[model samples]
Target: MADQQDELRALLKDSGEPTLERAIAKAREMVDRLDNVTLNIAVTGETGAGKSKFVNAIRGLQDTDEGAAPTGVTETTMEPTMYLHPTMPNVNFWDLPGIGTPKFKAETYMKDVKYQNYDFFIIVSAGRFKENDMILAKEIKKKKKNFYFVRTKTDLDVTQEAKKGETEEQTLQKIRKDCVENVRTLGSPSVFLITSENLARFDFQELVNNLERDLPDNKKYALVMSLPVYSKESLEKKYNTFKKAAWAVAFASGGIAAAPVPGLSTACDVAMVVPFLIKCYYSFGLDDGSLEKLSKRVNKPILEEVKKSSLVSAIADKSSLATKIAAKLAVAGVVESVCSLMPGAGSIAAAGISFVTTRSVLLEGVKELHRVAEKVIEMAELK
Candidate 1:
C-alpha cells in the first residue's frame, strides 16, 4: 500500500498537474505513447551499399526471414519501401531508393523519397564513403533531421586483412581513420563500421548508443523496446526500462477498475500486466521464432536451454493458451495459472486480489522474465 502510494505521488509530481484526475490522465497518456508511439527510420545509400541488409538487421530479421528486406548486389529497392518491425508495427524502417545514379540527383532523391517522413537517416557505404553520401548528409542536415554514416562489411575487411598479417585492431583503426577523413568535410561525422550478419560486433552497439542518446524520449523507448536482445548490455538495458515502467503500469492498472469483481477488480490489472510481460518475453528473445533464429545463427540449441526455466515455460504456455479466450479471461486466467505453477511468481491467487496484490504479481512476473533473459544471454554467450 505504501509503495503504491509512493509511486502515485511520484507520478503526480512528474505529471506537473495539481489534481489527481489530471495526473491520472497524464499517466495514462504516457503509457499509451510508450506503447503506441510511431518511429520511422530512413536508410539510404548508393546501390549495393548493404542498406537492405542493415534495414533487415535493425528490424531484427535476417535477409532470408519471411518479411526481410530483399538483398542482392543489384539494385533491389526502387522506392521507399517501409518494413514494419515484426513485433512493433508502429516502428517502421524505410528502405529508400539508392542515390548518386545518372537519373537520381542527391537533392532530387531526397524530395522523391519524402524526407519529412522519417525520424532520421542512415547513409550506408560498403567500401569507401562516396561524395553522394556526403551530399545526402548535408541535404538531411538542411531538413533538420539526424543522419548517420555507416560503413558496412567490416568483417570481410578484417578477414581479408588477417591473411596479410595485419592485426584486427590495426585494420579496424585504419578503416575508422579513413572513413573519418573521407567525411571530414561534413564536420567529421561519426562513421559506424558494421556487418549485417552480426550486429553485436564492430560499431553497431556504438550506433545504437548514439541513436538512443539523440532520439526523443518516446521514440528512443520504442527503439530500445523494438531492438533484438543481442547482448547482456542490451538485455540489462531492456530490463531496466521495464523496471522503470512497472510503476506506471501499476498505477495505471490499479487506478482503473474495469469490472466489479467479488473482492477486487482484477480485470484491468490483468489486462495491463499480461500484455506488458508478454512484450517483455518477446523483447527478450524468448519467443519461439526468435529463439529458432538465434539457434541457427549461433548453431546452439538455445530454445531448449531457455525452456528449462519454469517461469519461461509458464509464460510461453500461458501466452499460447491466451489466444483462444477473450482478453479479460485470458490474462486473468493466465495470471492465476502462472502464479500457481511458477514458484517465482509468488503465492497470490488471481481472485480476491487487490490493486497492491496485482502490482506485486506483475513485478514478480517481470523479475522472473528478467532472470530467464539473463540466463539466456549467458547460455548463448552473448556479451
Candidate 2:
C-alpha cells in the first residue's frame, strides 16, 4: 500500500495535476477512453482461405460457439459480416466477402464493404499468396489503411509434409519461402503463417505483436485485453496491460464521490471494480468455459488445478450466481478477506478508501489471476 501510494503521488506530481481532484478527473477520463475505444478489424480473402476461422480464433471462439462467425470451406460470407468479440463488443471483426468471386471485384469490394470503417485489414490465404490477394493488398494500400497478410492452415501443411518424412521446421521454412517469393512484388511484406486450430503453435503471437505495434494506444489496450491467453507470453502481455491501467481504474473508482458498495463497509465503486476484475478473469482464461475447453484439448483436469487459487474460485462462484444481487453479495463476502492481506486494509471505509488501497486491491487481484493463468499455460505445456 505504501509503495502504491508513493507511485501514485509521484505520478500525480510528475503530471503537474495541481490537485487530487484534477488527478482523479484525469484518471476518470483515461478509464472512460479505455472502456469506449473501438477497434474494427477487416478480414478478407479468397473462398476457403480460412477467413472466418481466423476471425473466430482471434475472437476466442470456436466455430460452433453460439455467437461465432460461421466457418466453412465455401463462401460462408456472402457479404461483409460483422462478428463482435463475445466479451469485448467494442472490438469487432468484419469477415468480408471472398475475393475473386464472379460477383465481387477487387476494385469495388472496398466501397461495398465500407472500407473506411475498419482500423486495419487482415488478408488471409490458405496456400501461396494468390493474384487476388495481391490485388486486395494493393487496393487496401491505395486507401491508406494498414493491412497484414496471414497464411492460414499451416498445421495441415506441416502434417502432410511430416508424412513425407520432412521435419516441421523444414516444411515451415519451405512454405514461408514460397509465400515470400509469391509476394516479393510487394517489397517483402511480413507474411504470418498460422493455424486457426491452435493459435500457440505458429506465428499468431507475432501477428498480435505487430498489431500491438501498429495500433493506437487506446485501441491497443482494447486489443490486448480482448485477446485469448493462448500462451505464457500472451498472458504476460495482458498482465502488463492490466497492471499499467490499475492506477487509473483505482483512482476513477475510488475518488471522493464514489458510492459505497452494497453490504460492504468499503466506499469504493464496486461497479467499476467488479467489471474490471471480471474482464481480467475472462481475459486470463480463468473462467469455467475456457478452462473446460482447455482441459478437453490437453486431456487434463485444468479446472481443478486452477481453482486452487482462492481468488479464482471466488470469481467462478460469483460468475455462476443468478442475479446481480447475489453476485455483489458474493463479492462483498470475499473482498475483505482478499484485501485483509494488506496492512490497515480492514480499517478503510468505503468513502474513505485511499487510492493506494484501491490500487493495491486491483493489482493484487490481477496478479493472482495472472499467476493462475501462467500455471494453466504451464500445465498445458503451452510455453
Candidate 3:
C-alpha cells in the first residue's frame, strides 16, 4: 500500500504542485489546455509561392487531401482563408492573400488580413526574397510577433541545378546563401528551404524545432501533438510527451473524490480515461483514416499491420470513435473488460482506485498506441 502511494506521487510529479488537491487542479488545467489550446499560424507569400501546399503539409495532409487549401499558379487566396488541422481543430492555418499584387503595400496587406489573429507568420518565396517580402517582414516584426522566411520548390531547384554540373550540396548552399543575403535586412533571420511534397526531407524538422522553441509552453505541446509522426525519433518524442502527462491523467480521473463507475472493479471516473485514450489514438495516428492515408501515401498495407495488436484492433474496428467508444456506456464496457483481468480490481472503491492501477492502464494504452505507430513507421519506411 505504501509502495502504491509512492508510485502515485511519482506519477503526479509533472504537475509540480505539492498537495494532491493542488496537483489535481493543475492536472485538470493541463489536460484541458492540451485538449483545447488554439494555435493559429499565418501562411502568407506571393502568388504561387506554395503557401497552400505548405499549409497542407504542416497539417499532415497532401494537396489532394480533403479540406486542403487549393494550390495553383494563380492567386488562390484572395482573403484570409482558414484551414484547420485535420486532427486538431483548434490549431488553424490561415492562408493569407499574396502580398505581391501590382499595388502591393505591407500596411494595407496586414490590415486586410486582420493580422492580430495569428500566432506567427511564415513568409514564403519561390525564388528571391523581393522588396515586397521585406516590407511585409518588417511590418510583422513591428507588431512584435515571430516571423519566418521559407523558400519553396527546393526539390525542383535541386533537380534543375543538378543538370548544370552542380551537386545537391552546392545547389542547396547556393540557394541558402542567396536567400540569406536577401533577408539580411531582417537581422539575418534564418531561412528554411523545403519541398511540401516531402516534409521529412530538407529543413522541415528544423523549422518545427524553431517554432516549438519560440511558442509558449502550452502552445508548444499543441504544436508537437498536432504534427504527423514521420519518423522513429518523432514517434518517441510524442510518446515521451504523453508519458509525462500520464500521472496528471491518472490523478484527474481516479484521484480524490471521483464518482464511482459501474462494471469496474474500481470506482474511478471512466469519462476522463476514455477521452484520454482517444486523444492518444489521434496523436499516435492509429485511427483508420490516418492509417489509410499513410498506407496510400507509402503504398503499403500499414493499416492491416497495425490491426495486429488487440488494443489497437479494438479501437480500429470502430468506424467512429466518438460514437462507438466515447459514449459513457461504451467506456463503461471498456472499464469492465479491462478491470476484470486485474487481481484486486473487484474490491477497489472510487477513492481507492489506486494510483498504480490508473497509471498502469494509462501506460498500457499509451504503449500500445506507440507500438502500433512505430510499426507503421517501420512498414511504411518513413524517415
- Per-candidate TM-score against the hidden true structure: 0.85, 0.86, 0.87
Query: In candidate 3, what are the lDDT values of residues 1-383, reduced to their tens digit?
Result: 45555655675575577766676677778777777789999998888888989988887787788887887757643767898877777989998887856444565877778889999999998899888889989889888988998898999999999999999899999998888788788778989998888887788788888998999877888888888877777788789878877766777664432433444434344456556777788888888888888888889988877777666765665565433332333343434543543444433332334545566557767876787788889999987
lDDT of model 3 at position 227: 86
Off by over 4 Å in 3: 11-14, 100-104, 254-264, 267-269, 318-353
Better of 1 and 2 by lDDT: 2
Select the stronger candidate by TM-score from 1 and 3.
3
Off by over 4 Å in 2: 1-5, 14-18, 261-269, 319-353
TM-score of 1: 0.85
RMSD of 1: 5.5
Candidate 2: residue 115 Cα off by (Å)? 0.8
Best by lDDT: 2
Spell out the clash pairs found in candidate 3. none
Score candidate 2 by TM-score against the native.
Answer: 0.86
lDDT tens digits, residue span 1-383, model 1: 34544654565576588866565466578788888789999998878889999998887788998899889857644768889888877889988877866556665877888888899999999998888888888888998999999999899999999999999999999998898789899889899999988888998989999999999878888888889987888888888778777766665563444543332234335567667878888888888888888787778888887887665676678654333222333354434532332222222222212334455656677777888788777777887
C-alpha lDDT of residue 200 in model 3: 78
